[model samples]
Target: MDSFVYSVNATVPIFLVMILGGVIKKLNIIDDNFVNKANKYVFIVALPAMLFKDIAQSNVKKDFDISFVLFCMIVTTICFVAIWLLSELFMKDDTMKGSFIQGSFRSSAAILGLAFVQNMYSNTGMAPLMIVAAVPLYNIYSVIVLTFKAKKRNEDGSLIEVSNAENIKKACINIIKNPIIIAIFFGLWFSVLNIKFPVIIDKTITSVASTATPIALIVIGAGFEGRKAIKKIKPTIIGSVIKLILQAGIFLPIAIWMGFRNQELVSILIMLASPSTVSCYIMAKSMNNDEVLASSIIVLTTLFSSVTLTVWIFVLRMGGFI
Candidate 1:
């Protein structure tokens, strides 16, 4: 119980940041145009720098928990499939279907994954390896989803075209161009060859990289608007169920199979089950797919994570992960 209170208290700062974003949007103090600038600041500089710093400074996960990695792959595969099937009922329009499905299956790695890991583990033993292991998985998953949902033109001259293979191709190209994935590749190469960062370079990188979450969180806050979510209620509800329920349900058993238990496994599992990334709303919108629905789902799922995160933490502490 005390743990729950403390954990929830830690989450308050994140919510406050989100509220600040909402307030900014409401006040129109931060023009919509600036949001793009903020994106550039966070994505191109702060985020990539942070990844480089973390990778350079940290000891690599020499032997990734293959089981954990496997779980991540399998569960995400299942999520994409599940969302595709679900889209048939509620989102037959190919463009909307692609974005909606990807949104359902994807997650906000920055906010939920990195921030939550930093908070839960603090100076714990497992965090470094978890971060490294999670990096490739998250990066790959994100690119794949985004590519699949990218704009396509149908034969009938409709603005949206949907093809599983097309999305896969886009994802492959995206992964190649992605800075994070590139960083991960470098990190992995350095790890395999046993490289270490020089003290000065490490310090410099760490200083720049450290800005990622704090600044990104603020930007997320600065961009959020409740108005964007009005018509997206249905997809939001549908996505919440898939994310908080189905994804978690499958992941728990996989954690047990991986031989992790208690708090550690709980942390990983809850993260796996977290709501899809808030960034997806923005990305889907940028690609001109069901932006309203995507944004709504992000808002709703983020709200529900308050409940799901607490429950998962309790269960993990109780040793239910195994």
Candidate 2:
């Protein structure tokens, strides 16, 4: 009961923040063009700043777990492959493949995973660093899917040519040049080198990085595309189940296998069950892979995660797992 209340309190503000995003959109305070501009700000500018600063500032000596990180990687990869194969086997057509498969594997750490952790622990910021790893992992997977794969028809499973290799190569190049990637690069570089950035430079980066969460939430809110989501709720729910259930199914057993402590298990479960990344949808849209379906999955999963997430939280709490 208490956890539910806490979850609700944490979730409600994000909804409000999203609404505030819409309000900002309407008021013209953020500029109508800001919608296009925002992708650059969060991905290119603010997010990188945050990543570098967080990784740079974090104490390198705190309860590190290479085993856990490796576990997450293997489990996530397994889930990704299982879903890609399963979703392909069960559902056909480019639209459906792109819609369902991406949602199955792509986890929204910034909004859902990071939010849950921050709610559980105020200002500790360790979770954000774990997210540095998640970024490259998420991108590499998404791009590979975008790059080489051709979608098959639902009726006959025939490959339909959509994108060219030149475009695909360009897309890969662009993804590699991502500001967040750059930030993560420098952040890790500093961490490995054990060098402290000057205080003023660190402060500047921190201030810019702080904009990421709010601006991201706002853009997320504005980009909800709920009417489209309503049209596709059934399929969207199916995608959400893949993300929430399938990932949890894989991760939970593995966590238990590793003799994970309760909080550790709960933390991984929450991350596994997070909504599909808006960034995935954005990439799919840019890559011309069922953008509407991707958007529907994003909005619906984000909505469903609010409820399913609360249920998971309670389950973990009751079982003394969280």
Candidate 3:
């Protein structure tokens, strides 16, 4: 019951904020223009700032776990590659392939990982290490898949075919120039070098970082198309199941067999099972993928995570795993 309540408390307010965005959009307080600008702001500025702040502040050396980090990276790689390959083989709609693959595998590790672990352990535990390992790969894989699978349209809305070489070039450039990726690089640099910012600069970055999630969630809500989401509901549900259950179902037992328990196991669970991050929608919209599908997956996953996460936690506790 306590875990259920905690899960609800942690997740419900996020969707509530999204709902508020939808309500405000209906009320004419914010429009498509607002949504577009908010998405860009969160993508280029706020989200990167948040990533930088989180990664930079962590004592990477103090909490270093090479084996655990390698496990996270390997699991993340397997999930991303397997999902992308499966989506390519089975999904016919190129427009949705990127969104489905991304929405299916990417967890909100950076945002929810620490919170969930801290809730259980009264400290950050291995969550930060998980973020350090998994979050960068999350963004990198997203950029790669979204770039390669992005649709190119002519002025008449006809599809344009580019060469594989072109896509390779574009993916490389996008990965190099992605704001979030760049932020992660600098954050790692700062953490490794033990760099400290002045109080004023730190506060300014903190302020900007704080706006990332809320504004991103609002943009998702305001931009959501209900009819469009309903049309994409099948993929949305599938994506949610993959995010909130399937990945964890497969990887978690392996983690247990490898001797991860308590905080380490809990952090792994968040990496494998947390809701698809709201940034999936932002990146999808910005990259010209199916934003509608991306948003629907996020909405469904977030709504269902309250129950799914609670169940996972309960099972873990019952088994004396955490």
Using lDDT, give the best candidate's number: 3
- Tens-place lDDT per residue, model 1, 106-169, is 7664345545655655633343445565556565665665566555667776667567886777
Candidate 2 wrong stretches, greater than 4 Å: 23-32, 60-62, 111-115, 118-129, 148-175, 285-291
Q: After superposing candidate 3, which stretches have Cα over 4 Å from the reference? A: none
**Candidate 3 lDDT for residue 310:** 94
lDDT of 2: 0.67
Better candidate by TM-score, 1 or 3: 3
Candidate 2, residues 1-322, lDDT tens digits: the string is 6666766675666557767876877777776467657856676687678667766665534535677667666766777778778766776554667556777688876545555676676643445445655656766677667654534345576655555776478657866876656776777767766788688976777788888767776776666566766776777777888787767865676677778755466557656887777666556654546656776676666666767777877766776666
Against the reference, the lDDT scores of all candidates come to 0.63, 0.67, 0.92
- Clash counts per candidate, in order, are 6, 0, 0
- Candidate 3 local lDDT, residue 272: 94
Q: After superposition, how far is residue 21 of candidate 3 from its true place, in Å?
A: 0.8
Among these predictions, the greatest TM-score belongs to: 3
Model 3 Cα RMSD, Å?
A: 0.9
Tell me how far candidate 2 lies from the true structure as C-alpha RMSD in angstroms: 4.6
**Candidate 1 segments whose C-alpha is farther than 4 A from its true place:** 108-135, 152-169, 192-194, 319-322
Better of 1 and 2 by lDDT: 2
